[model samples]
Target chain A: MAEKKVYEKTLGVMPDVISGFCPGCMHGTVHKLVGEVVQELGMLDKLVRVEGVGCCGLGQQFVSHDVIIAAHGRACAVATGVKRCSPESLVYTYQGDGDLASIGLDETVSAANRGENFTVIFINNGIYGMTGGQMAPTTLIGMKATTAPFGRKVEEHGYPMHVCELLSQLKTPQFLVRTAVDTPQNVIKTRKYIKQAFQNQIDGKGFSLVEVVTSCPTNWGYTAKEALTFLREKMFEEFPLGVYRDKDKEEA
Target chain B: MAERVFMKGCEAIAEAGVRAGCRFFAGYPITPQNEIPEYFARRMPEVGGVFVQGESEVASVNMLYGAAATGTPAMSSSSSCGISLYSEGVSYCASARLPVVYVNVQRGGPGIGAIQPAQQDYLQATKASGNGGFRMIVLAPATVQECVDMVYEAFELAQRDNNPVLVLTDGVIGTMMEPVVLPPMKTDEDIKAMKAKFADKACTGHEPCKQHFCFPGSVGTGQEIANKEAEKMYATWDKDVRVEKYLTDDAEIIFAAYGISARISRAVVKQLRAEGIKAGMIRPITVSPFPYEAFSSLDFNQVKGILDVEMSIPAQMRWDIDHAVQGRCPINECRRSGGQLLTNDQVLEGARQLIKEVL
Candidate 1:
């Protein structure tokens, strides 16, 4: 009898090691997508991850690849180092919002502005998860955070940072997409876009960043199911999901 | 011996780095060290290397941090305030055991004190303490020629220990023009050989190297053990402690100095000896693993006083000297600060006063 297989774990996921991400977090989904993409592209042996600081760095426990954790927000600069020296190595930076948008904005902006040939898997949850629900740079307007006890105010905390839009202003990045994994369909799309981003690097295209709009259920004060609803209802409204930059399509 | 060239101190250090197989350099421009990035910007392309003028010192050092992870021979240079920004990246490299060389072409500091030469960063450079109290072997080059030699060898020393090494130079050596015989340039094959050695640890995507390296290395599991190993590593640096004991064996008054301050002390020692004061100098070439041995080994009865000379207000290196001396002899300081260069005449006068009191 032939057994039908519906789901199987990717070998790209480290064997038997539990991730440090909180339960029901979409970080687990994103990590799975990254691993699947690398394995699908046959780049598992050549892939080098520049791990960011913050929750996104939890992939280290689960992803099977050579990685070097960059000091908070410096992953892009580190990826640039690896890519520039070994052009054949498939280099990517897995960064969280605070690491990419706030403290490491200079490094992020510079690496993308230079159009360094690399992939950036940016996980944009609205709050700081590892640090106990502090306000991240991407925290939405009026969203309550530990730093913003009364919720974010226009006069005080400023509006949420639109990372994809901000990076879109630069001309170098070849593929820029905002995708998510809360829904089954969105998870499929995230895999496709991530594959495209990694493909962009494999094709020797310029910078590619797949910003995954995800949920931090633990930090958002919601259960796993409610967080998915929050992603669909609130997160999608503040940060609309779409491909902001596609150099090939624009040229086409 | 490689060919000799008349070059500025900053350019010489850059050339020495390139010749030592450093194919990647990232640094932000600051006083007394701009020539370094400028030289790399001009020179790197010819060697198929990468040179980045980082938007900030933090970014520059982080770039080196990433590049060094792939087993690339990497170096960064900055002056006083700029190096402070590098403290974060330096700490990461030390913990990750990335062998990257750094040069602090120091200028007056303590919150942007001055643009001219000073040694106010003595404690900072030796402390190299970014976070977690990690220490690096800090090499202090006293001359432009020594700057080239020390920076050329620093990459090797850094790789030998699998740790970061700092070459601490000041404005006098960083900007001074001097004739230096450069080390032989490393070939492409040499660089390949150097990188092949780190195959086990580097993020080069080789099949054998499959693990990620996090700071504190063992991540959450074995950090205390890792910290203890780092503590043990510091003990191994005693052999790398470099200090020049100049006529200190039989002197009545000893001058303790480093970098440009040491040069002045050397000239003052000669002038003082000619005047029959029995003055000698002990210059620390490597300031981190400081030559406390120089003071402890001294015949304290013959040494009437230890004069710590520097271009800093409250002599920073005196802490090490005091520890070495163990209160055996009275320690006096001849200091010129706030961008002032210590004059040989001024140091000689200070030595004479010490001689009167001690000798």
Candidate 2:
């Protein structure tokens, strides 16, 4: 028998195109995971992707769905609009830490609190990757960023935000999970968490958020390998990987 | 058949929105315009529409952007400070060419000015609504009826132009009560059909569609191309320029105004005409596609001078009047600001003074 093809690129993705993200940025991986999940769930035709600022905004170019780019940090609000207006469509916002936790904190919290029936795929890479490695809301203490030259200090800059933890406290969000994409196992687990978030939306279970701990090698001033190690060793310490809230599992 | 009901200006505008098939509303509470959202909160659900009292003006406008991107008739309203916060989202809407409707119930301002009715935001509404020099189709309504009517028509104009439209009223019109014949409510099927018609081009997740919706950087050549397209769209809006001319054919002096100021100016014209003064009024219903043509058509040789009446000190509409008159006639301004209403007598006195200057 002829060899059978097992794995192929997702039909929800544009083929063989270079995104505007920096080299080795995990935004591409997250985008791929999202595209694959959408394709697997037979939601390719029903996916409305709302893009935010920073490198994650480039997901609009790579995703083969209807994508609307929002103003900086306004993706969650925009996604809320899309989902509410077209309830049959699966709408998701792809945002960076700066876009979600910084300028968009109010929108993020408000959407979660409203229990908006949509999915949020938050990429937390500890630094602002698009504007040349500036400090982000998720940036770890002692992390070196352009905006934090002296390295982040708890007294000066405050501690890095734990978005999953913060959002999980809200009663409205149906699912809230924190996952990383640094290793093979972690990447698979991250994909699973993201799929579950999308599935929650499909099931009409109001807001679900998957926070992906990502590596920004170019922004972090490290090689791809070093960045992966840093994500596992340092970043994971501040943002531990686990499901913070699962309404279905909790009820069961 | 539509029923006549005495409704507040803000409530009427909200009713008009629902009647026009506006299925999505997201707004923040602001003085003078709070009734808009409050009305929508009760009425939208009744019509099977979505209503979200957003976290802030910023969030509400962006939410409108999201809903409008799906080609849903979405609207938002705010007062001056709140409108300022919506600027960024408005620009995004323009960049994306989404037909969104917004209302700014004008109030005294340069900052957190008084909440009293004022026309201080004329320049902001007409000239620079948002960054990148995008112009919205700004409608100035002088009456509660016009407010309801304009808010009803604004959705069509917005959809026709594929841009955001602003219904600019003052706190007076927003809070005042009047009998208005509301338009018939849009049936659910009509709204669905409209959505289906736009689903192909809209970012509503329908398949066999364009991959990208409307992001400046994501599109070809970034915002430069999108902006160029927007400029082209703006050039075609000359056909939409609207103005109401009263007794200007044989008049020697013309009073230029809009919104509440225009309402006051109309009364002033009637009073001046009764007093045997050759006074006429030119009211711009669409302030952005301003009545420049109206000024140009006037027999400048026969005209004595143009008096610009406004509720803002130092005048904001005067610039458009000056541009329209183009030195053909001397222009004088009669204005009040800081939430002070311009009385008809004040306008009458100012017009008499301008007539004296030209005579």
Candidate 3:
């Protein structure tokens, strides 16, 4: 038999690079987690990940899970359709804080309340990373983005919204957790929680949410390393970390 | 076979959709159209379908999108305010070329106008209800029977063209209870055939049941894909636009109207014909294609004038009328907005005045 050299570069994974998100954005981290989960669960063939507008909008770039980009803040609703239409496939959404927590709060809360069998991966960077770092609902106290350059004060801006805590209180959500990737320890924890959230949906448990506390180094005016420190020191204090609700436990 | 039963227009639409093989109904309750979801809530389960009262119109339309993408007949109904909320999903459906039947029972609106019948949504339904170069096959159902008939035809057209179809009715038509005879419900085999043909082109990959020499890709090359789709869509739409002409054969003046406005025009037509004033009606059944040939083919030299009757200020239907006539016929408009219906007497008065001014 003739010897043939197997190509090493061409293998199972995302493209070498893509134009979906800007550099130093946490969308890449979230996308990686989502793609990894789809692969691990052997659901890449039976998955449809709906994307929304913002930094993480064009999920088609990295999400090899038969991705479709919906209108702004409509990922959850679109995923609802995908999951309902094909209950066999595992449906998920990769959304940003502005996409889910701000403009799409109704869909998020309602889908959770309906206990829709799907997974939601929410990234809270506390700013609109796509539209030039505008102030977002998840923006931490005293944080200054483009819209809140004077510093987000409680009197004028209201308190930073903790979506995980708020959604955990709702009666329908089966799994809700808040984790961060500010450090190596939290990064590992975020991955574990994200995998579990996807697993719950695959098991037809119900609506599962994994809110990852992430960072935008360019938007936050910090080095990539320094951005991680800020997320751990400041963002962690306000948002906290750990599971807020798990219906699977209640059932047990 | 003509049978009779007293049912609300909205209820007729729901029942007709059920008969048309729709197994998924998702919608939010809005005034003048709440009966649709309520009916579905009661009857959808009996047919072994899923009925979801979506949290909002946005979610409802999205749910429709999801269900329809699965190759099943899925439908959603809402009024003008709620339909506006569904624009995002409409655009998504349009871009994806998914077949979904959307029922828009319109009320007055530039912004939350009122819960009353109006033709204010003519432009939104026909022109650009959503984004992209998209045109929905708008079906204007003037009578309660039409509300029943159009719902079935809308899904049929939706599946045929693999595009969304809107049943554009008004608050009166949606809320009014009248006699209607619905056709026999579609069989599972019929629905299965449609589901196989109209499901998303990319979803389940390619076909396994080709009789002839099989070729890769059902739609062919990516470069020629959109043009081919456009050509197929226009060809299909050519046969889909339907209109009805009453007393137009020997009329000096013709009234172009649709939906509840068309119902008012009918009474005016009857009174004008009795008075020998020769007023007729050309009711557009499909508002998106707009039945341009029906108006353009008429002998404009013999026809003196056209009055576009609607219930919205500034006459939205006048645009389509003028486009059809192409400056050959004189056009006038009679309309009222802000949740008010244009009464029969008002239309008669306008038709009489137009006769005096033009003839």
Candidate 4:
């Protein structure tokens, strides 16, 4: 009997380099999904990934692709430049909650509004991971962070940003979805969303974004197992997973 | 030779950039330089290029960064306050070695002081364009014709150094209309070949998707070494120093000026020469890698004094002149600030006063 192959290495990520993400962090998982999408699409040679400043910038270290590390909060604008110049090359920006929802909000909205032919993978972790857990724009009202030691207040910090909901209001973006990677079942769903975002760009369908509601175990102060549990119980309650917009399926 | 056509400096600059194979431009609306983006919007599509009126000056420069990284000649144009916004992205471009070009049609400012015209951004242009001790080759053009030529050459200089270059004109030069013989527009093939040269390091997807990249914003030996390498590269820019040394061979008083101020200074030189005072002018076309050698080489014994004529209060270019003159001759300035244009008679009187003090 011939041995069956169940798993194989993907060259989308560099071989043998350990990721520096803290344990229980979803950056590695999301990165793995992106790497899988890159390989599955046969775009390992022509993918230009623009990584925003923050934990997402670590994509430069292990992503085996043409990479541009954009200045803090400027990845969307940078990706716009790359996509406009090399229309044939696949381009995307990887950004975190703070990088996308706060400092980079204008770039995020403008790129999506223009319907730029590219992809955006937004990791909404509710806290600034690389900066050691400052409250992010997407942080829940009662969530505690280094900056909000006593937990966020409704009057002081305001409400969390629902990126999928906010961007869905735009008429241009071809695809917009919210997903998670906290459970094996959700992880499979997350991969599908990521793949669809890539396929949107490949089909020249214009801007597509997948907002992943992830957890930063180090910053959230939880063990890997407990973090997944917390993400399932707490994070899911705030940012429920679903497709926010799909231009292809919408009435033309 | 191309036919000479009368055009505004800003329009000439836009056309020159397109002709030089600059395929991408992203800029925001700013006073005294609005025509630049307006022209690009109408022209880029015709030339098979792109134009983006970005969300802000900050986003526009970052867009230039992304476009430039792919080996495409990219540019952005702005005025005083807008260039301040461009500083961060400009610094990033320098560190990343992404060749990019920008134009600053300066208007007066400590804080949007006035919109007409002023040379107050001289120090800002040459000394501290941005953080991280990064430097750019700043070009100052006095006329619409020269503006066209400098803009044409700026892309090549940027590509050669793999660094950012600035065309420092003024509201006077940017808005004023003059006859310019434009360079031939670059063909589609020429632009493609230019980008192909940067294919190796450019972020364009080449199969295998290989890249080793890092941003320098930390305290480490790697950044230190990169800074040192930048310093060595800046040192070689001395060869690219451009200054218009006019009749300094037998002059008693020399006028040091640039841009519109330099244009005025030339008339002052002739007016003084008519009166037999033997005045000459040294104009810096390339303000950064400033032609200090032009000043240091002057026979100080024969030269009575050097007058700094400018449109700023403290004479911003004085810093470079001080370094060049090195106390050999007294450096006094005839300057008008806050959008005030210097008159030829006013500068001639200042030159006479300087000559009296030195003699």
Most DockQ-accurate candidate: 2
Compose the digit string of candidate 2's lDDT tens values, residues B1-359.
Answer: 76999999999999999999999999998898999999999998787889999999999999999988887989999999899999999988887788889999999988989899999888989898888888889999999999989998898888787889999999999999999999877787877876766665688675523464766433457667777778898899889899999999888989898888888888888888898988898999999889789998889788999999999987998988888788988999999998999998898899889988996
lDDT tens per residue, model 2, A1-252: 999999898877777666777777888888889989988899888898988898888776667888888999999899989899889999999899999999999999999999999999999999988789999988899989999998999999899999988987788899999998777898899889889999999999999999988899998999988988998899888899899999999999
TM-score of chain B of 1: 0.97
Which candidate would rank higher by lDDT, 2 or 4? 4
lDDT by residue (tens digit), candidate 1, B26-64: 988798889999999999999989998888888888889
Checking candidate 4 for backbone clashes, the offending pairs are A45-B207, A46-B205
Q: Order the candidates by DockQ, highest first.
A: 2, 4, 1, 3
lDDT string, candidate 4, A14-106, tens digits:
788889888888888888898888789988677888989889987777888788889899999999998998898889899999998899999
Q: Please list the C-alpha lDDT of all candidates, in the order they appear.
A: 0.87, 0.88, 0.80, 0.89
Where is the poorest 10-residue window by lDDT in model 4 chain A?
A: A8-17
Tell me how each candidate scores on DockQ against the true complex. Answer: 0.64, 0.72, 0.24, 0.68
Q: Indicate the residue-level lDDT of B220 in model 3.
A: 38
lDDT order of candidates, top first: 4, 2, 1, 3
lDDT of 3 by residue, B1-359 (tens): 66578999999999999999988889998888999999999998898787888989988898777666667788999999899999978877876777899898888887888988777888888998976567778999889998888898888888877788899998898888899999788888888887778544534212112101101112337525754675567666777779999899988999998888888899889988888788899999888888988899999778999998888887888888888899897898888897898888899889988998899
Which structure among the candidates has the greatest lDDT?
Answer: 4
Which segments of candidate 3 are over 4 A away from where they belong? A1-24, A182-184, A250-252, B1-4, B198-232
Clashing pairs in 3: A81-B66
Score every model by TM-score: 0.97, 0.96, 0.90, 0.97
Per model, state how many residue pairs clash.
Answer: 0, 0, 1, 2
lDDT of 2 at B328: 87
**C-alpha lDDT of candidate 1 relative to the true structure:** 0.87
